[model samples]
Target: MPEFAEEAEVTADAKRAVRVAVLARRRASTADQRATAAARVQAELVALVRRLRPRLVAAYVPVGTEPGGPDLPGVLAGALPAGARLLLPVLRDDLDLDWGAWTGPENLVAAGRGMREPAGPRLGMTAVAGAELVVVPAVAVDRRGLRLGRGGGSYDRALVRVPADTLTVVPLHDGELVDRLPAAPHDRAVRAVVTPTDGLRTLNGKPGVVPHTSAGRTGGQ
Candidate 1:
């Protein structure tokens, strides 16, 4: 039992180190670079929406220096087919995520944790299960689709509500996609990643198919 606890601690430390490094890199990015990455990421996501034609999409508004840029919600709204709805995450007190509808930029209000969330009525966590496509945020993702988040576990909890077959993706800056990342038992792995330079790359051979198995060493390996 002690050995298992120590192993978990080591994994947490590794993830923290990676998070610090990645956030530093993001902080150093100039406005122009962020703009360019934003454009590219938006383009890729737009393309994905077009291809999937999802009647409902679950996504979030990116905060400062986060990938997908501040304009992402608007960009996605423009790309989605008419009458289709966009759901943005609302952070709950327990750090779990509740969903809300993205009506427009004006409807988005400043939220806790440096986030911008929809001001509309709250949708239960299970709303994500109804989305045909889910776009999440990641500090980084490995080729195996193991995601490194900000350690809040908000998205991790929300992701479990997503159907295994629903298309889940993350948008990243050019080099944020790496060979591997540390994972814990509750961590969720995504099916694909979208980067400024690479556009979209599916980790699973088949696109949009997320393996229900956890990505930690004891599980995925």
Candidate 2:
């Protein structure tokens, strides 16, 4: 083998550095603070579900100090109206995501990714397109809606399937929502952010550099 240089992207190293710093801060939080934040996050998520009233919603299970906690899906389930559904992601070996219905905590099963996923029917990856609302996990997000995700690049692939007008939400721990971060054209932006302290707020300005038709709408996304 000759030389294996880093990819030919200026933001690659910058993004990696940002991710490391952000995750470090996240892992540094005390258990008590995380617990308090989890309660606040659950309340905000409940309020969001009531406001959106989505018949189908897509969400994720938190791993490590990532927000949302373990009770999110169950809590949202109770908040939803009868016949409504909530979807949780199933991590594929290739890091792409499949969806499954979240029935209750009893149905949660541990996965290779260190997440507890709903042991329900496997919905194809494109199932996310049908969700009226999507709540994703992010390492950090900026005021302009630019989201910095973990290096896996799974959400980037699935997000393309979301409808243009559908809302994509990311939950952060207050300070994690910043003014800016390392971004390239390929990094898709989220529309709104829900913080433990601030609750929910829509971002200003256009979404991160991307074709209009490809980026899902942020009209309160």
Name the best candidate (by TM-score): 1
lDDT agreement with native, every candidate: 0.85, 0.80
Model 1, span 88-147: residue lDDT tens: 999998999999999889899988898899998998989989999899999999987789
Q: Backbone clash tally for model 2? A: 2
Error of 2 at 136 (Å): 0.5
lDDT of 2: 0.80
Listing every candidate in turn, what is its Cα RMSD in Å to the true structure after a full C-alpha superposition? Answer: 5.9, 5.6
Residues 1-221 of candidate 2 have per-residue lDDT tens digits of 32333442557788899889888898899988988988887777777677667899999888789887877788878888789999999989999999999888899899975878889899989999999888988999888778888878888888888876778888888688887888766677787787777766677564342222211222332
